[model samples]
Target chain A: MITEQHILSAFDRDLESVQAMIMKMGGLVEAALSDAAAALETQDEALAEQVRKGDAAIDALEESVNAECARLIALRGPIAGDLRTVLTVMKIATALERSGDYAKNLAKRALVLGQLAPIPGAAGAIRRLARQVGLLLKDALDAFIARDAGLAEDVRQRDLEVDQMYNALFREFLTFMMEDPRNITACMHLHFIAKNIERVGDHATTIAEQVIYLTTGTLPGGDRPKADLTVEGQ
Target chain B: MITEQHILSAFDRDLESVQAMIMKMGGLVEAALSDAAAALETQDEALAEQVRKGDAAIDALEESVNAECARLIALRGPIAGDLRTVLTVMKIATALERSGDYAKNLAKRALVLGQLAPIPGAAGAIRRLARQVGLLLKDALDAFIARDAGLAEDVRQRDLEVDQMYNALFREFLTFMMEDPRNITACMHLHFIAKNIERVGDHATTIAEQVIYLTTGTLPGGDRPKADLTVEGQ
Candidate 1:
């Protein structure tokens, strides 16, 4: 007895709810990235633990987003643009969930680094790097909400700076290790932590691409520029 | 008007082609992992280049699989079990493509490591770890093809072995770097290579989880056992 219009309205409601969930997940990841960076700078073990614990919520939200997306696809049978929108939302959720994992990892390394003697300038450099990636993620999410491909492309371009920052941090960690053998373990942890944060930047860039694709129905041609060829992360 | 049976058969054909692509992608990844290990052991720059170049094909396959899955979801509007099957194939393809990326990363590191003097036994240890993960991927793909959740669960359990192997390699690299300051750069590259390979195992296990979910309609309760908590990958 249901009319086509009723079903169409139902689809719209489902899509709206799912999109809201994506934004919510993005907000949580942004907070986690920034908070984890602050915790590292301050050597706040309690804050780090909280970041680690909060990852579960992000994971749960991702699962819900994915499930809701799948349900929308199967039930509504959206074609063309609506299908692309659902697919984009699912992809964004996956990327955000991974960024959350990396933030949690940075927090884990921060806790370990807290017990060691402060490496000159390491924590501050790491915090700066984290802030850059956090802002990149925030912009990407805003672009998604605004449906602004230009903003998304701008966010994509910004990742080159993040890569340069990560490379500099990598060399500094290497120098610290070479300067003092005692610095080896701490520096190694720091190196991985920086790598993890760089990965968060990579995720942010990927989210931007998703936004571009959703808006334009095509992925940007050619590779996004990379300052370093070092391959790490998904 | 087209018969419902005709639509069903068309869906089957599309799915069959997509699943074949998944297997092909999986095969390429498995070979890439093994070859990358051999290239590292023999310091064969040519083989490493081959692995890197081969990744483009895997990326193409992933794109094709994703597009085909999206098309099926839209045109065929597969519901319930059929929808789940298509979703599973898409997820497995994603895992395989990431596994391919890690293999390519291993090759990149091999090229770097070839420039430096070998760390004692590092090549053999890494090759062994790569082989373990390779075997794990083989089983995961087999599970996908055979619809064998039991096999998938077995693969899941075996990741613990991969984790333990990687942990041992991490410590060995640390010891090597500490023993000789000159060894630091080479060991850092090796540590990341081993970590990348370990991530290949993680992706393989993720493929296994997707297979399990398809067969049983549930993700395994709780976290998969992780040997070490040093977070390093997506």
Candidate 2:
């Protein structure tokens, strides 16, 4: 009943649909990250509450993406490029979902820290790290959409910068905690939220790697040198 | 030119080959983990060096497993179960590769610490955590090998325990560094290495999740109660 043209067109259609859904998910996550950062800035318990409620939608989206990928792979036997695209989407869904979790983590901590006096811009490192990671996520997804391996490679390089920022931020927190031991728990929570952001960056880098592999049939670690950085979270 | 029987048998052969290779990779990673622990206990830089050297072979093996999966997926056009098997193998290969990376990270740090002074049983926590994660790794692969979702679920539950141990170990290290600033650098390395081991445990949980998904067609996180742990990781 099914013809070859039908299958190819159907594959293309499904790929397009998946890409759109992923971008939508990316948009939601980006907004979540920004909102979480703003929540910390304003110590907005209400916005923090919203982030916790929003996580369920992100989780549902991830599940739906996986289900769609599975259904497509079953109904249509896609070839290398199509297969890679589906797999990449599936992997990115997990990463994006976790990024949402990171945002929620930050929001949760922000709520707790709301009870205390402000540390006078204690959230600066987290904001910078979140923004950097958000850009990486955007660029990685854009590269995938554009099928641009060069853009993907560039995103991979940016991961090192995030890693460096993560360590420096961690060191700064360590110094803060050392200066005031009472800040240990609060700073630790912030450190983990920052770590979650770095991990999101890593996952974006992973998507970039998959894009390069899909396009060129080679992984990027061979001759491509990773940027030198503080080397934490590896 | 390809017969149905040929395709089926080729799929079977390749799947079996991939399983074998995954188990082999798992074994190598376990050895590296154990050797790294031993190096820590005995201040054996030679053993740590050996683990570092052994990682290249694990890397090579992982590459082969990946290539084999790609080849099978391309050539055979495998069906539902066969396809999941190949995909799972690819996923497991990645988890195993990261396990090796963790072992290598531990060994690298052991090399550095061994040069500083005798570690003086600093390897205790690493040894315990490595063994726990190693067991989880083995059980996860076994579940994959036998297609046993039940065993995989058990591994998933056990991951919580490993995480708790890592957290406790981390807190202890944090306290050690807090008590004496001189321990900061060494403790930092130890903390990250422990974090990597804990992550390896989580990756094993992921493999288990894939197993459950492959068999039951349901992802485990929704509506399921969180695993009860005496010492929670987060």
Candidate 3:
């Protein structure tokens, strides 16, 4: 004999399992990003290659997460707030999978950049950007788990700092390219890595936005201030 | 007073309304891409600005689609195939919205590239690529509406051609940049535009894949081949 309470507890357990998979995916993405940044700085082809291979795992995790979410919706028939929670998880998984791809891209470029002469201070600058975005992602996931709308909004504001850092790096790379024609190839590659990190910051902000929406039932009103000079609102 | 048959018919009508919004959004995205491509070829700053400002409508449409899908799910409690169809609409909206953003980014770059002397033949090549991707998006939406798995699979294959075109253009831009230091800035910008189109092609492929999934209840077997050089497997 099954009571309503049994079904409710089972749904809770299922949601917890799915949410744990999301956290696991988030952890994998974070490690990939930080590791890719470190590989770029050290020109470690091996580490970079490892990061590239690891992306398949992230991709698999996202697939599992999506399948699980769809199943939960179909089986549980969750309504209102529960439905919003499920949808938000699906959106976050998409963002995380994309960020993982960016990390893989950085690794591929790192392999290429490893063969070339290291640009002075360029990798360090990119690492700083990566670290900042990593913290943004870490905190966004934290906010999601805690359902802390305030902390999520804080993460949203911090993306502007990431954007500013990216701008500074972009100008620096352009200067390097202009100063020495020989640096053009390296600078171009470095510019892309910086841009990738900047986009990752945007994804982190997206996660924060999703968390806020999940908790508050509405997206933030004011436009998240954009300082990414070139790419123009994307 | 409503019978079971009436309730079933109402669900069908609601679904048709939501899908109609998707087609409308698709049409807007296609126009934005083609117009941006044209603006690039002619260096029409005014036209480019129009495209940039027009992205808001696409974004709004996507938001509306999502909201309506959520409402339908909550109110109707759709299950099985109906649930998958609604979810696919949401996914397609996301792809269309992102493609629209890419078009807007192209316009933004076109504004900058206008001040600089045009790179010989680059704009024409990009236009051709955009046109190919535009056709892909059109066909993908058609596949979705008709529930034609074959057409969806066809659209998936066509993206490889877009990737090949991108690789050719990438090499062309690299040669232009290497031949003259003066061309580096213009070439870099052109490269990004080409890259964006390749991504648009990917989004179309995503839509096509979603269609197959919705129709067949399983993802297509094997990985779709990729040929874009430099951005390896992105």
Candidate 4:
């Protein structure tokens, strides 16, 4: 019986270690999003380069988390809820990795945008959008650690705000391009950057959804409300 | 000893079931891509709607595959190569699901584009790109099923062709927008649709990477060459 207790404790420790790794990965992604936004706002090529380089770390961490999850399952053979938690961790890591990729893509575009004249207010709007997404990501990860379904739902709802901001920026960029053809090139790059940020929000929502599923044993119903009416009339 | 053989056979059967489901899911995604492109080329709204609705089945298959993987792991406790195969199945299903979403997005855009005047040869370009992506997806999945690392590497390399086509399309769309403002909206939508196709190719490459990792037990080293210079520099 003592040996059984020891085995259970070791399993718990393994699960905690996976959670810790996920938090570490989440932190890297958060930094990537923030640094990517800051680099875009300041047009800092070096910082943008840093954001791009940082992605490899996030990708590596995701692989580590995945390997650990598989190892835990194979060794301990966790059942039901414990199994779900490990699977959720793997899913969340993938979402974070993709979010990191989007940030890297944004930073890459920022480096290109640095060469051209900025469209007025574009950088500020992008920074705001990025900030919102970063916060949602943090909240989603917190909800996962705390097992707080309510907070996860809140993060899911907040994604609509990100989408709305993206839509506003989409229209704003279109107006800028229509007003002056010179703004076209810069606006297009900004649009792609904004789209990338919006994708980060979507990934955050995915994490939130996974959290809810982990806690509730069922996914949330109904389609997520999307406000990014960029291509309307679907 | 007889029971051990029975257990091993059951594990093998479970793994085979997951692989079969993945192939079924891949077929749906390939169809989605082709139908989306054909709808865009022919401006068939009905076909576009059908493609949009068809995504639900792909999504359902992904859920089934995930559940099966979790159950197999918990019940059978597959280890080493078997565990990796199951994990790869889940990852591949996810990539396929995202590819389906992109195809659905393209179909939605196709519905919109059907209302407007056709851009000369843009539909053909999109169709060709979609066909290439579809082929890549097929090869990637086949490689996964066959454990053919060489074929997986070929699929990885073919993604570059999709990216190059996307770059060329980007330049073409820019020319169209610069020549006439009337083309801006259509071209923007078309550009997005083409971007979706390119993204499908990326997901295909992701599956190929997973296949290579599954077969060889090591991810391919160095970054996958990206030829999509849409956001160049830094």
Candidate 5:
């Protein structure tokens, strides 16, 4: 018969494996985000295609993480903190997968925008936004690995900056579109790319929130501050 | 000592209760979508506020469902198909919660747009799109309750129509903004509202996909046939 200690060790090993996969998935997502932003900045269609293709791997990792999570829960019957950790791993994988999708979308838009006249300053602003989101995602993953709720909260707070950047870009795009209708098509695509980057930040915040919940057993109180003034009156 | 049959029956009862909660949550989301669209069509600020306020209930229900799913998993130790069902329930609750948020966003935008000049045919098109998405959400939940994969696939396919409608509206809004800059601010808000409704359809499709995966151990393949031409040629 299998001993109790053996089962406990196996569960710990399983948990570590899942966590490792999540980190691997996070790495791929970070790379995709950077590449997508770089592709946009340089108007590199080939690099954009690479980011789009890379999404499938991230998606497959999510599927594996989900299966492993379900398997661990079924076979080990984890409770309390261990259970929360497993569930959080699943949630983090989901957030990472979504971030990957947003990156893919940005890359897809970059490919089309490459064919059009470049919008001055828009690509640079998008790259900065993507970099900020990348930093937030890195901190979110690190917090998850360390179970540091404070660091996770820090990541969550930074998302407000991302929203502000997105709102600024929104106004800038409106100005570009108004200056010349010829810029409208290109500006609209850039606006979407900016929006996609903002969404990546939101996903990063979601991962951070999951970490906070996993650590504290309670979500952060009140709504996270929203700095996106695009629809402020509403 | 508890017999095997006792544990099995208890698990069944737990599953039934979670499913009931999911149905209730779905009902609230459907109502919110309808009301948000109605408010936009009639420029009814009071109705919009009602839809916005109603979102809290949907969110609360989602929290309850998540807690119950965790409890069921910990207490019952469900495996294989039962485990998938529990996970799918949690996912469906999340999708429903997101749909509620989108509906709330639509209502919020409607409140702002009510003060602006009406965009010709835009409000009516949005209402029709919302109605179709509401129908899709209804069918997705029904498929979940009945374990009907075919119906879920049908819901998944219908999402393409929602995307097509959204793309058409995008062009219409672009025309309005180009013809008169006075319509720019209103059209931008309308564009966002339409985008939110399109996101609602996406969430409904996600729920349907989860239902398909729950019923059949495999997700439907081939990229789900997106019809959104906004970012086409990527």
Candidate 6:
């Protein structure tokens, strides 16, 4: 009993709802990552516990998104653009789920590394990396929400900074382990936590790329690019 | 103008052709990875050249597959299962492309490390790890082609072995670097090459998981609880 106008309106509503849900999920995941990093810095087991508990909510949100995406795909019979949106939502859900997993890993590593006395200044580098990745992740989602190709491209470019920091942190941690063999276990735990954050940055870049692809039929890489890198073009 | 039987036969032919292309691409990528390892071991620019050359063919195959997939999606109103198959093919193509990129990175590293007099005995571990992952990559695709859940599960389990070997190799390379500071660059190259192969193992695991999901409607992991070795997997 639905006309074309009704169908289009319903599709718009569903897309908005789905986007809202994704933002909620992304916020929760970002909090979990930040808390995990904070726990590492402060040796706070309670924050780690919060991160662990937050996974259940992330999982639930993911299941909800999947169900909604499935319903939209089945009902709307969308064209390539809608199809890409639905597919990107599904993929972003999975990416967020994995990011939650990484955050949990970081929390656990924090708890383990906390048992050791302290490594001065190591925690700050991890914190900076986490903050930068968090910004990238937020901007990537913002790009998706606004269909802002320029923002997505910026997010993609930021990934290199995260990688460079990760590499430097890895070497620093390696040096720490070598300097004091007793600190090996703690440093290794930190190494993995840092790696998890770096991977989160990678997933953020992936989401940005997907956004770029979804908006434009062409995938971003190599020349002959279609989208301009400024908000004015968006 | 076409009978149902004829249409079905065309689908079958198209499916087989796509699968053949994917397998061919997979083989070339695996060979390139193996050659990268060999190049690093033997300090052979020739083998590195082969890998770099092979990447062009992989790119060509990927483009062809992308075009065919687009045509099929546009022309054929594939149903749910068939849609899933087409979508999986696209995602699998991406995984294969990334695997090729990793191999290309390995080859580039090999070329750089080759000029600095190859480290003796370091390549064995890299080769062994590459061989294991190569086999896993082949077997994973085989399982996908056959829709054999048992084979897919076996490939999933085999990934653990590659992970173990990678960690062990990492430790050994660390020891080598610690013994001689001059070995640092060469050892880092070996580490990244091993890491690339290990990542290939991971991608194979991801593909196998997708195959399982395509059959069983459930993602991999979280089914049977076991002693989790990796910090991320638990």
True contacts kept of each: 0.43, 0.10, 0.29, 0.59, 0.49, 0.02
lDDT of 2 by residue, B73-143 (tens): 76787767777677778777877887797798788877777645332345787888889988998899889
Give the CAPRI rating of model 2: acceptable
Q: Show where candidate 6 strays beyond 4 Å.
A: A49-71, A115-117, A167-192, A223-234, B1-14, B49-71, B111-120, B174-189, B220-234
lDDT of 1 at B205: 90
lDDT tens string, model 3, B1-234? 478778788889999999999999999999999999999999888899999999999999998998898888888888889888988899899899989989998999998888777899999999999999999999999999999999999999899999999888878877777777778778878988998999999999999999999999888885666776675532
Off by over 4 Å in 1: A1-5, A229-234, B1-4, B229-234
Q: Which has the greatest TM-score?
A: 4
Model 2 chain A worst lDDT run, 10 consecutive residues = A225-234
Name the candidate, 2 or 3, with the larger DockQ value. Answer: 3
- Candidate number achieving the greatest lDDT relative to the actual structure: 4
Interface RMSD of 1: 6.5
The second chain of candidate 4 has a TM-score of 0.98
Candidates in order, interface RMSD in Å: 6.5, 5.1, 4.3, 2.3, 2.3, 10.5
**Candidate 1 has which clashing residue pairs, if any?**
none
How would the candidate models be sorted by lDDT, starting from the highest?
A: 4, 5, 3, 1, 2, 6
Clash pairs, candidate 2, are none
lDDT of 6 by residue, A1-234 (tens): 568889888888998999999999999989988888888888788998889877889988987897687667656766667666877787788778778878987887777676776776888889889999889899999999999999999998888888778877877866766676555556656766777798898789878988988788677765322221110110
TM-score of each: 0.95, 0.86, 0.95, 0.98, 0.97, 0.82
Error of 2 at B203 (Å): 1.3
How would you order the candidates by TM-score, starting with the best? 4, 5, 1, 3, 2, 6
Instruction: Show model 3 residue runs off by greater than 4 Å.
Output: A1-7, A231-234, B1-4, B232-234
Instruction: Output the number of the DockQ-best candidate.
Output: 4
On a 0 to 1 TM-score scale, where does candidate 4 land against the true structure?
A: 0.98
Better-scoring candidate (lDDT), 2 or 5: 5
Model 3 chain B lowest lDDT segment of ten: B225-234
Model 3 interface CAPRI class: acceptable
Give the alpha-carbon lDDT of every model.
0.87, 0.78, 0.89, 0.91, 0.89, 0.76
Candidate 5 CAPRI classification by DockQ: medium
Between prediction 4 and prediction 5, which has the larger lDDT?
4
Docking class of 6: incorrect
Q: Alpha-carbon error at B1 in model 4, in Å?
A: 3.0
DockQ of 4: 0.61
